[model samples]
Target: MNVISDQRVRRGRKFGQVLDGARKVFMRDGFERASVDDIAREAGVSKATIYAYFPDKQLLFLEVARGECLRQTEEAEAMVTAEVPVRTALTIAAERIVAFQLSDFGQRMFRIVVGEGERFPGLGRQFHDFGPGLIHARLVHHLGSYVAQGALRIDDLDLAADQFAQLCKASIHEKLIFSMTETITPELARRSVHGAVDMFLARYGVGG
Candidate 1:
């Protein structure tokens, strides 16, 4: 079922308000631990008001999570521009990817989806579609442009895009994701982004 179908979720002036509240609660408490009462209290709406907009906690959490992913993807998209050199564009993209992966919000969302995904697989799919899937699509679009311009020589855009995205997460991502580190310093993030851009350009840049 479409959890976010318009028929399933009614819209209202307070819709955004409720989503904001639920995001905070879900981020703080995860899906299973987050209570409707807590979400209603955080949203500044009554339980009835929340129910009037959303049918249940799962749908509400999905909407909030999807919205957050879209928001982050849009922000990353906005940072990449065609006017810049391919190297600059790639560096910017890598930086954005690394920063998002290292963010507290991003980490929480990832954990929530991982924790609840087995019970509700749609949650995992929704997160992937809106987050990594969207990001990969954007990379393919931009990388195609670079290839067309003869700045990059990628024969497999999909594989190249996925590689670059993974490259950006090389050093720091696993540490944070596996709970080996509580925080990443700016210097570490910079090294990862720069290393990713350098490796990508070496493999795909003109004549590379």
Candidate 2:
């Protein structure tokens, strides 16, 4: 009768608590040193409970990081529409994504992935495949409409999206994730986003 599964009914808070705990443990101990037992104890759950939600310790941490990526990815996908216009949507979407990815937690996760993922390659691929590649696909799909509507020239929409993502990365992720630069201001965010969109539109926008 209670076959709905132990992980579901109250999983909302439990999973969230576990994820939060895991982020801290992972951040403190590093992936190799952080233990599932410690994570479950910190989250006030049994080790089996952690197993119910995540296959392994790294996976548990991966889920936490991936959830953050998904939040940003969903926000990026929200900008696509026939009415918003491709360039405008890209600028706004990029601004939001860049902010999320460059935030403090995002930076830590980035560092962890870059530092540890060399040995645990799947973890790195997981973030890259879903977080960035998926966002780029949606961008290309939306930008394709502009080409059809005669606002942009004929070419690969996916390639265009890749270029747009690169532009955003140049403005924010490159500095935050790669360079370990200082924090960026909202004003700087807007300026960077606008300039990237301007360059993109200039390349493909029909008139010039």
Candidate 3:
């Protein structure tokens, strides 16, 4: 590789190491307890190396949370497309969202944010803006196209999008977050997704 390519590759490797270490530290000890020293130790890098990639523990944690959110968003985005009917596309996205939220990594990241968010005021906002906010924007764009094509009638596409997203969670999200149960059955997720789609179509469906 050329000099620039080599440097880029090295940076990418370093970034991976830092994120891996940071994820472990943050998930193990919570945000307040996780320190740069601990992350560096886990990552097998120096404190300076951690700082080079992230300015502070908060920023590092933010990146971790953002990474998870982006991963989930990408998966959901892939399922949402105009080629499919609105109901089908939404059901696909909802199922994926529920699956992601029910995963161990998803619950862990959610706990970290909720538990330590108050101490770091900007942290929660940043997470929401980057994560759910991005997903909402994408949905809005997708829905807007249907609206233009006369497939739906939504006075407020933004509100409609948010509602569908929340509806996907339905009865399962809170229980998962609070550890109310050990498992989220596929049947439950299907119920939630279908219910959300039915409700959304009730209000926004083109025919009725």
Best by TM-score: 1
All-Cα superposition RMSD per candidate: 2.2, 5.6, 6.0
All candidates: TM-score: 0.90, 0.79, 0.87
* lDDT (10s digit) by residue, model 2, range 94-150: 786677666777677777777877777577776666456666666676677778888
Error of 1 at 202 (Å): 1.2
- Determine the backbone clash count of candidate 3: 0
**Where does candidate 3 stray beyond 4 Å?**
1-13
Worst ten-residue run, lDDT, model 1? 1-10
Residues 1-208, candidate 1, lDDT per residue (tens digit)?
A: 3335434878899999999999899889998899999999999999999999988777787777667767877886787677788988998889888877887778898899898888875777867776688788989999999988889998999999999999999988789878897789899999999999999999999864
Q: What lDDT does each candidate get?
A: 0.85, 0.71, 0.79
What is candidate 3's lDDT per residue for 161-180, written digit by digit as tens? 88988988899988886779
Best-to-worst order by TM-score is: 1, 3, 2
Superposed Cα RMSD, model 2: 5.6
Provide the lDDT at 28 for model 2. Answer: 76
Better candidate by lDDT, 1 or 2: 1
